[model samples]
Target: MTAAATAATVAPVRSSAGGNAASLPAMRVAGLEFRNPVVLASGTAGFGMELEDVVDLDAVGGICTKAVSIAPRTGNPALRVSEFAGGMINAIGLANPGLEAVKRDYLPWLPAHHPGTRVFVNVVGNSVDDFATVVEAIDGMPGIDGFELNVSCPNVKAGGLEFGADLQALAALVSAARTRTTRPVFVKLSPTLGTGVTDAARVAVDAGATGLTLVNTMPGLVIDTQARRPKISFGSGGISGPAVLPIGLLATWRVSRALPGVPLIGLGGVSTGDDAIQYLMAGASLVGVGTAALRDPRAPERIARQMRRWAEREGVNDLTTLIGTLQWPS
Candidate 1:
């Protein structure tokens, strides 16, 4: 992107005066400026318009719209979601209104409604070409600041976890999408892949990803003893919530250390400002709120406030200073 185009996408930075710099948690990631660090995770905030009535869209820094596939997805069977002791398990199966519907119904509604809030469309596909095709089709659309490749979705059978797990496949998928648009492309990775997480991150970046969104939902299963069956209709689902917080934090920290300057959107079990602070400290430029927002639409706004308060108390003029500040004992 040219300087003029990049400038257009960014919200202006607040001047620091009288120790007020810490008041604005604004940041620039992958050549795009965000008003704050709190963003609504993908799938949770569908196309922004879905939660417009309940949540204040402008309150959060950005919104990652639901996954959009090449063709509409019917999704999985009944009982797509279930509750568990650790957190929530879901087998949403990447259900969406398809590409054309999004281009017609969703994309235009964003800038007209929530102009200031940055919008990153989540793109999913059944193949590498599918991923590139979606990005190419919507690359220049209005109200879109970037793309989040949903290669890490555990619920989908094809073009999901496999794209993220196989190093060669991941490289090819990212490379294809990279050729489609100049807009930022963030690869969302699976959390279940232990050490491969960093390896995958490296492969993605090398293949032309602008940045990375660490730790998608971990694949898991929940059983009902009395019913002797799975809790969700899909038999198994992606586990999210507080149970995955530590896992996300570790992934963010590890990838951040390995890739040093790469931008990461940290999310898993984030529900509070303090939790977001932990992510920033661990190396995330932004923190995504998913499971918590399902319970409360106002969670993102509340969390952003809490983060500013923490920054004020810590005398941090810029939240970016808190990024990757974790002190590992030698």
Candidate 2:
């Protein structure tokens, strides 16, 4: 299918509540309406159903499942996650049950249980065709609200940051994936792109991305002095937590400024309602909670509750007004 044709067919599925209200914290992004602005970042939430016993799934704005590839992956070796002073590093290697298993096991269960919660699948692959294949597999699957493309994943074919670092490659990947599904496509970017984040945002949007997810985990390493070895199984892993809050904020600000009116989902180091507000002010329509959930499975719901309290306390009737309201020193 052509990009234009796919775009034309894709429409935002309205919430049961319908349009946003001034007194509510609801938001609409790229046709998907969220009850709140706090989303569970992919990889941390484990396909959106794993936390049912501990978390109130319907409480958060949405849930992004871990990266789903065309084939099942075992991920990295042991010690997939390790903590630092301010944050944590992980090299889970996108371990997932593959698309077929997801469709059979998870999709049906979601709608029957958490009907109100929005579910976005995080799609990852080693090549542009790989991404397209995965998206095609889940195109019309029930209970899936949208997709967050993990373009920040290293492209084995092109090498060197793969699809994310190269504008042409990123556009091609997005365009290919766009043809596969009419669902909203959110491109998850890398902070390592620096000023390139703006360029990437433009390319992704122009290539048919419905929205952008600013600032995936930055790469980092933890060392063990006594063992003279890296802490995690992988020599280097993505860093996430409080340490990346400023990085995520700056990326959101830059991308929002560069691409006005485009929906953005900001993540990295968002553990509190205040942190979420910072992201909103910086230009993120929605904020994602990841590492904090690792520490406490109920963190996303807690953060959302706190955000609501904060909004009420400040007398901000509408949370949407907070977007891009940052005041800078002239």
Candidate 3:
């Protein structure tokens, strides 16, 4: 990646005159600057506005908002999310107040996207037309820093084929979303095998995706050991949490190396500063926290603080220095 490209994504602040400049430095992801490497994954962090009630928002890298549709979506049925042994299974089908609601309810409250951490909006759709409508709706929504295109939604009726499974479909959808947005577009993909995340990532880049969010959850089910039935009403839901971190790391590393210039926002099961560091070394420019925060709303901030300590302990003053530091097997 070009130095200029790298510089484009980092959020510029006064450079914390008091903090340990001797620790982690600033980093960027696909032209969107981040104060640090720890960001709250979409669907996990509410509009980057709600958390201020618990902690200062200025501390973390960024906030990726919940997935939004062109219009308001009532969302899936009751019993949407269920806890599991090592992770979670969620069937909350893109529930949000929708695009306009975001502007009306969330945008006007924010200060700005300045050194004030990035805010990436997660978008979803059933078709290319669905994507275009969302793109157009959020065109100039205030406080929105960027868009995270959710193309990984499993097609339940299509025998569970992920939108990212077919190269042509993936490229076409990414291109459609890319052409409609002026803000940075971060394409989110599923981890299902043959989804060809790396190949789809190339298409995303070629079609103008600013970066990639590696990965949405994998489709799975919790079977009832006693009843001999599927636990969920839908029979399955997306899996997330610790059980998936290793796969997340592998996916982040593969895509980071494959898509030379594009930035990567690593997410899956990030729960600690060292985990964030590990993702960076594996090629993620920024790391996102999800399921952990589900159990603890303050998880994002906690990780941010932990990252500060981790940076100091490692003797690496700048977080960006750790990007792609790992040597993968040839």
Candidate 4:
């Protein structure tokens, strides 16, 4: 379908901002309601607990906890992160305490401390079954409103990137995950997929994915000229921050245009409200703040406030009207 047609047909379902107020920038996706469009992207904010002291976790719409696997992961070697001219790169390798620990320690904290903020567990795996395994285990877990499948992590040696590129594997993976949870399942896609991303989005949605997160950081390598070696310990890492903003926006536009009915959590290099607004105009139901939040823990709330201010100034009472309103040249 044409972008214009899709935009008209897909009407965003508005919901209350958790009864906080009628004017709050609230939105609902796949039955999960967000108080606003801004969300703390995974990996940057840890599990929302890490930022408790510095940030008001409930200020933003929601938080996507770091990738959780079936087993614990120490992650990549030393130089896991490095800075560059455009943005930052990191090879965190989905390092986390794993599923059981998440169940025992991580999930419980959100409800008690940040009751207003929504939570989506980012699930990773070394294989097809592993994805479902973790999701199934946490399906009934309280405080988790949904799941984001990390099938596009470039830093991993095994199943991460491989599952994203192969349509059959991607289909099977999403299908398996779909059966394990009744909550929303968002497939995080890779920006490096180029023109094929739309096809992948179709496959995922057909396999019963609830939505798509566009996208994960692109694979990159930063060289240390003085040291005559790669700066990142993993040699190559996933590049994030401002450098990936356009890449992610383009992916969101393509997928949103093609699958207008599918909900999208637009993430990449967002630091300010204008950046978040661009994602909304490009058709994202939600905007994720990662590198910016890492740089400043207060960024998520600030961005959300900025969005509200911008909306009020522009007289856009319902932020949902701004979604998928992108216009292409005739």
Candidate 5:
């Protein structure tokens, strides 16, 4: 079926931003309601607990925890991150304390500290079964709202991008994960995949993905001229921050247009409220703050405030009205 045909199968569901939009910042995705549309992107926010002292965790919509595997991960070697002109490059290799550790150590702290906030675990693995195993392990853990599959890591099994780039593999992975959990499933797509993102989105939704995370960082490389070696320990890393904003916006537009019914959590170079608004206009149900949060721990709270101000100024009583409202010229 064609993209349009497939999209028509489901109707667009607008989120309920509370009865009086002026008072609340709520949004819904796949029947799950969020306090707002601003979310802390996975990997950048640690487990959402690390920033408890720096910012109000309950101020934003939700938090996506760092990618976790069935077993603990040491992550990439030294020099895992490097800065450049427009953005930063990172090859963290999905480092985490593993599934059991997260549930035992981190999960208990969430409800005590930030009871109102929603938590989504970012699951990473090598094979399809690995993804399923991780999902099954954390399926009913308290304080966890959903799962966001990280299929774009560039330094892991199958080179990370392989699963996201291949339609069959992506479908199988999503399907396996779906069976293992009753909670919502979101597939994070790689920006480097180009047209393959559209195919992957379709297969993922059909296989049981509740929503989509529009992009992961694009692959990049930086060289240390004097040393004649890659700046990052890994030869290449994922490029993020303002440099990929346009790429992320375009990808969000394309995929959202192709899969209108699938909610999207958009991110990439989002540092301000204006940037978050752009993602909403492009069809994202929610916007994610990643690298920006690294620069300012309170970035998500600030962005949420800005979004509210922008909505009031534009006479947008309900912020949801701004979503997918972009007009195309004749």
Candidate 6:
């Protein structure tokens, strides 16, 4: 959709100087309501506890854990990530404490979390059953508010788009895990697959996804032009940074239009309040910051501040009213 259409669909922001974003009406995703619309991206925020002091944890929308596997993973070799033109490439290979350890270590620490803060655990699996196991295991864990299925990782052997490669596979993964718990499921998608996001998003919902997070990092690679070798040890990695903001906006807008009732969480290269506003205007009900948060854990608050200023400038009243307002220019 054109930017002009996006503008037309959203309600103009009605300004109130010195407004407190926290005082705005709450936003909900899959039955989980947040004080605001900011979420700490999965990988960038770790298990959601590391930045408690820097951020008023209880005030933010939610937190998602770094991607976790069914079993412990050592991750990629050293030099697994490298900076590029407008983003960074990473092949971290979903490094995490795995399910068992998460239950033993991460779970215990979660209950002590501030009650107002919502936590979502991200689960990844190589096969249908693997995902079910992880989801079932994490269900009802002391403090987890929801589960986000990570479908953007690469499959070592499949010459496909990983969990997102095929709709049948994605549906199966969702179907298997949906039966295991009552916690809401948010399917994390990828931008690499391009327009396929629409189909994948719908399929996930039909299979039982309560919400959608668009997107996972776009796959990328950095080469040492002088040395004639790849910059990352894993060769190719996921790309994320400001460069992805536009694409992320488009993806979020499209999905929101296609699935008007399901909640959509936007992520990709968001570094400023304007970026968050752009996502809002494009139809994202909630926005997640990854790379920027990695650089500065307090970035979410900074973005929230920026959002208040921008909303006032734009004449927008309730930000949630801006969702799916995007349209094609006449």
Q: Give me the candidate number with maximum lDDT.
A: 1
Report lDDT per candidate: 0.85, 0.84, 0.74, 0.84, 0.82, 0.78
Model 2 alpha-carbon drift over 4 Å, by segment: 1-24
Q: For residues 1-330, could you state the per-residue lDDT of candidate 2 as single tens digits?
A: 433233322122333543432113567766767878888999999976788898777778788898899899999999888999989999999999888998899766777788777888899998999999988888788878889999877788775566888898999999999889888888999999899889888888889998889889999999988999999988899999999999999999999898767788999999998999999899888899999999998788778778877888999877878889999879
RMSD of each: 4.0, 3.5, 3.5, 3.7, 3.8, 5.4
Sort the candidates on lDDT, descending order. 1, 2, 4, 5, 6, 3
Candidates ranked by TM-score, best first? 2, 4, 1, 5, 6, 3
**Model 3: clashing residue pairs?**
9-31, 9-32, 9-33, 10-33, 11-33, 23-317, 25-318, 25-319
Q: Write the per-residue lDDT of candidate 6 for residues 1-330, one digit (tens) a residue.
A: 211122122222332212455444455556656767788898877775567667656556678888889889988998987887798888888899888887887755645866656788898878778889999888967678888899865444466558887887888788888888777788999897788899998888888887889988987778999989999899988899998998999999888888776777899999998898778778787899889877777788788778767778889767877776666699
lDDT of 4 by residue, 213-259 (tens): 99999989999999999998889989999999999999999999988
lDDT digits (tens) for residues 226-300 of candidate 1: 999999999999999999999999999999998877888998999899999999899998899999999888788
TM-score of 6: 0.89
User: How well is each residue in 1-330 modelled by candidate 3, as lDDT tens digits?
Assistant: 322243244333334422632224556556655667777888877776676676456667677888887678887787788888978888887788877787677755654533367777788877767777888777776656788888876444456566677666667777787678777878887787433678888777777777888878878898778988666666788899988898899898888777655678888988877788888898888888989987887777778778888877878667777778898669
| TM-score of candidate 4 against the unseen true structure | 0.92
- Where is model 6 more than 4 Å wrong at Cα? 1-24, 53-56, 154-161
Residue range 1-330, candidate 5, lDDT tens digits:
222233222223344434332224566665666778888999998887788888677778788888988899998999999888888999998889988998899767776787667888899888898899989988877778889998764324455557887777888888899889878888999987787788888888888888889889988999999999999999998999999999999889988888876788898999999999999999998899999888898788888888888988888867777778778678
Clash tally, candidates in order: 0, 1, 8, 0, 0, 9
lDDT of 6 at 23: 41
**C-alpha displacement of 19 in model 3, angstroms?**
4.6
Question: TM-score of the candidate numbered 2?
Answer: 0.92
Instruction: Please estimate how well model 5 matches the true structure, expressed as its whole-model Cα lDDT.
Output: 0.82
Candidate 5: segments with Cα more than 4 A from true spot:
1-24, 153-161
Total backbone collisions, model 4: 0
Best of the two (1, 2) by TM-score: 2
